[model samples]
Target: MYEFFRDLDRRWIFLMMFLCVAVPIIIIGATGKTFPEEPTQLVRAVFDEIENLPSGSKVLLSYDYDPASEGELAPMATMFAYHCAAKGHKMYFMALWPVGPQMVDDTIENIIKKDFKDLKYGEDYVNLGYKSGYEGVIKVIITDFTELYSTDTRGTPWSAIPMCHDVNSVQDMDLIVNVSAGYAGTKEWVQYAVTPYPKLRMVAGCTGVQAPLLYPYIPQQLHGLLGAIKGAAEYEALVIEAYGDKMARKDAGDNPLTDDNGDYLIPGKYTEGIRRMGPQLVAHLLMILLIIVGNVIYFVERRREGRR
Candidate 1:
């Protein structure tokens, strides 16, 4: 066994790694099954901040990422919309990045339009659309929203939109939820909007690389934070466990259908983060195993050379 493994071609190792990742993804895609996730304190904080809010509370959802970071950012963004809509919060969607409006549109289409069809636009929610000037936009809107944003994305004036009628600035919002990739994102919101006002509450979802930098503001300027796909998966699990029909049925003393793996059936849209995590988890394990085996082989070879 040692001899064969010692002489194993690099191609074989590559093949094993490929199978490690590909097999899980294919199985998950086919089965609609995902591994369970235990949400951390940070993720739970994000969920709670939204969950605890009173229904009809105004929430500013600032999606500041473009398509380039969509895979990492979109899942949480979708969940943020789903959770807010589920709670009957009045969503105010806006963007800092030029492409952010499209991201906002995608979330609105996928989660709100598809799932919460009864929600009326302008009253239940409104798209304030993208504004240039990055943090400058934040600075202005924090004081007088109409100074920078006088209309919704559809060109309807703010005075015309029922939700905007009472909303004068970010200060009027019950909570601010930000999905960000870089500058003019969570950090800027914290520094400009939350810090000075101190009355304004905020939470954020950001890329893995940006998570650490924003951690210091948590439970203070930022109520909670979700970092990267893992954070998204954990938050998804919490949301699904809370609101998914299968879990509801199970709680109601009915038997809920489960997959062969005993995992509860979940909608494909809500499982993006979990499905993506499957390949990553398997590949990481494979890498770990390879490192251990290579170390064992190196030590064994050193012993043999010493004996000779």
Candidate 2:
């Protein structure tokens, strides 16, 4: 058994990894069971920041990420849009990355337009679209929104949009929530927007690698943060727990069915980040087990050679 284990084929290891990932994913897809997420301080802060805001507050959502990092950032973006819309906040969407506008559009389609049909385009939310210039755009919009943005993404003049008529600059926003991947992202916002405008309240959801870099700015430059998918998962759990009943009631109207606790039903998609965690946990465990097994085989083989 020891000899066979020491000489294990590479293909067998690949097969084990394949099973580790695929089995959990298939089980989760069918049963909808996900690993439970406990809200970390960072995630809790993000949830509270949005929750504490008054209804109809103005929020600026900067999508500074592209599809390349969408898998990590999109879940939080979806939750952000949903939470703001549910809380009756007026959302102003803009992107620093060229493909960022598409990300915003996808969120609107999936979360806003699909879930909250009553939200009017220019009234409840407005898409300012993507603009050129890396941090240069952030610098310009920090003080003068009109100088950089005279029209929405679709070519409609800002004069036609009701939301744009009242805004003068980024400072006019009550809160700024940014979902970003890398450069021209959270760092740019902290420098160009929050740094210059100290009063501006900002929360950000960024890739895992960027989280540590931004930690020093917490509670000062950044009000809250969601770091990578783990942060997204925790935040998603918090939002769902707080707002699930409200969503169920809204969707079902009068005489909606409730669970034992009287909370209404919510869609499965709301817990997507959590659901993905199941596969992640299983894959990680499998990797750890494989490492232990490999090390054991190495030591056993080394001992046998020494004895011979």
Candidate 3:
């Protein structure tokens, strides 16, 4: 038995892992069921910070990412936009990377434009677009916004936008929310913006590799963080649970899952992070089982040697 187990083919292990991942994903898609997730203090802090803010609070959202990382960070961006809009916060959008502007625009189109059509541009929300200064932009904006941005993304003068009138500098913002991918992102914002203006509160979401580097700043220089997809997934569960209940109550007679037009109302995009979590959970369990089996085989072989 030990010889057969020890000589198990690598191909069999690979096949098992493949099934372990694929089967759960297929089941989740068909049934629309996901593993339950409890929000950690890290994620809860982020939610509470936003939730506690007064309605109509000024929020600056910096999109320092590009399309390549959209898969991991998009869900987080959507939740941030949705939550802010739902909370009646005035959202000011901007970016550091040149491609960052497009990411900001995508969030507006997908989340704000689609679901919250009542939100007027330049009033409830405005996009300042991409500025070329990188971290230098953060430093300047910390003190003066109009110095770099005299106009919103559309080329309209800042004076023309009602919201811009109130935002002379980054300090005027009630909160700084950033969803970043790489260099000139969270680190730059931390060093240039938040560090100097200790009174300014901030929260952020970043790719997995960047989380550890940013963790040291949490609950102090940085108020809260969504570390990666897992953190995003946990946050998603909390937001959906709250929002879903509110929607259901409003549509008391009709299906909460669908709009008045009989079309599906709940955007599937909102659930991306949570949906992906199902397969990840199964894959991790399979890995742990494989490790246990491997260790058992090693011990059995050692016992055989001792008998000899």
TM-score (all chains, Cα) for each model: 0.85, 0.89, 0.84
Please report how far candidate 3 places residue 60 from its true position, in Å. Answer: 0.4
TM-score of 3: 0.84
Better of 1 and 2 by lDDT: 1
- Candidate 1, residues 136-243: lDDT per residue as tens digits? 999999989999898889999889998888988899999999999999899999999999999998999999999999989978889899999999999998998787
Worst 10 residues of 3 by lDDT: 245-254
TM-score of 1: 0.85
Model 3 pairs in collision: none
lDDT comparing candidate 2 with the true structure: 0.88
User: How accurate locally is residue 171 in candidate 3, as Cα lDDT from 0 to 100?
Assistant: 95
Off by over 4 Å in 1: 1-20, 246-264, 286-308
Q: List model 2 lDDT by residue over 91-177, tens digit each.
A: 999999999999999999988988889999999999999999989998999888989899998888888999777888999999999
Q: Can you list the residue pairs that collide in candidate 2?
A: none
lDDT of each: 0.90, 0.88, 0.86
Q: Write the per-residue lDDT of candidate 3 for residues 167-200, one digit (tens) a residue.
A: 7899999999999899889988889988988999
Models sorted by lDDT, best on top? 1, 2, 3
lDDT of 2 at 297: 86
RMSD of each: 4.2, 2.6, 4.1
lDDT winner: 1
